[model samples]
Target: MYKLLFAGLASFVLAGCSDQSWRTTDIGDIMPPLDFTLTNEEGETVHGEDYRGKATLVYFGYTFCPDVCPITLSRLGDTIRDLDDETRDNIQVLFISVDPSRDTPEVLKRYTDAFGPEFIGLSGEQAEIDAVTNRYRIAYEYGEENENGDYLVTHSSAVFAFDREGQAQFLMRDSHPVSDAEADIKRLASQGG
Candidate 1:
């Protein structure tokens, strides 16, 4: 599953190579427009339309992830920090927990707060999560639980970027540099759609 995700991303990147304007893979045509309904950190139901006027980045992972989750969010925080105040305010990072069984709204709030004010955590019932993941072609699965009832979730690490109008724009892989992300986000913010 992971390999399939990687291959898809690679093809997207390669297809975008002819366009030198974007720093990351241009997915404006291939990816779907942003759409989902999930519970926010404040335990309120929110839809993707609520974020319509901002350049949004959505990442699927779990709060309990040992390494990748924290590092990815932290790097995103860094990317936002590098932007000017106005551009920073115009961007949002949505952290969607794939492991909703253990990540309640309160837990998600706490986990995302450490990243930055621009970061918001969201989760929902399994079906809602599955809908969003499937819409984006993201693949995630759980590992076998240990005696302690702890398990790991293996999920795609790509970050989906959407323009201010909720249009699909680009995709960022883990290998994409923060500098590139920052630039791409700034461009998205300026475009206002």
Candidate 2:
């Protein structure tokens, strides 16, 4: 199962994303303008609408994820660091945990803060999480637990970007260069929300 998830992630990430510019086309083929209400790392209620008027990067993964999650997040952090202050401030990264049972608000907050202060971690009741994931077509399932109660979650690995207008714009994969992400984010920041 883990292998299958990784294979899918690799395929998604490798899907011909050579263009460094923000894509305004073909967004209608998938759901656009994502919205959700969940608790942030601070344990406060946060609405997806709050991220409007800024370029937002939304990723789904748990703190316990061993490989793909951290690698992609680190790239995102580095990409943000490469941007100018004005552009950086205009961008927001949202880390939404699929494993809500183990990923409490505080835990989510602490995990995301390691990447950057600009990153916001979110998780909520199972029902709320289900709704968000289903709407976004994010495939995730919990793996069998080990004796220590540790388990792995197999989930889609892709970074989605929302323009300042709150419209879903583009997606970047793990294979994409951080510089390309920076360029795309800067382009999104320049657009009117």
Best by lDDT: 1
Backbone clash tally (model 2): 1
Compared with the true structure, what per-residue lDDT tens digits does model 1 show for residues 19-117?
445788889889889999999999999998998889899999999999999988888898788888888889999999999999999999999999999
Residue 162 alpha-carbon offset, candidate 1, angstroms: 0.4
Residue lDDT tens for model 2, 1-193: 9999999988777674644335323353476686998888777888888878788888999999999999889988987887788778888899999999999988887898899987989999888899888878898999999999999999988888887767777777666666666677678766654
Off by over 4 Å in 1: 1-20
Give the CA lDDT, 0 to 100, for residue 168 in model 2: 78
Worst 10 residues of 2 by lDDT: 19-28
Compared with the true structure, all predictions reach lDDT values of 0.90, 0.82
Using all chains and alpha carbons, the TM-scores for the candidates as numbered come to 0.87, 0.83
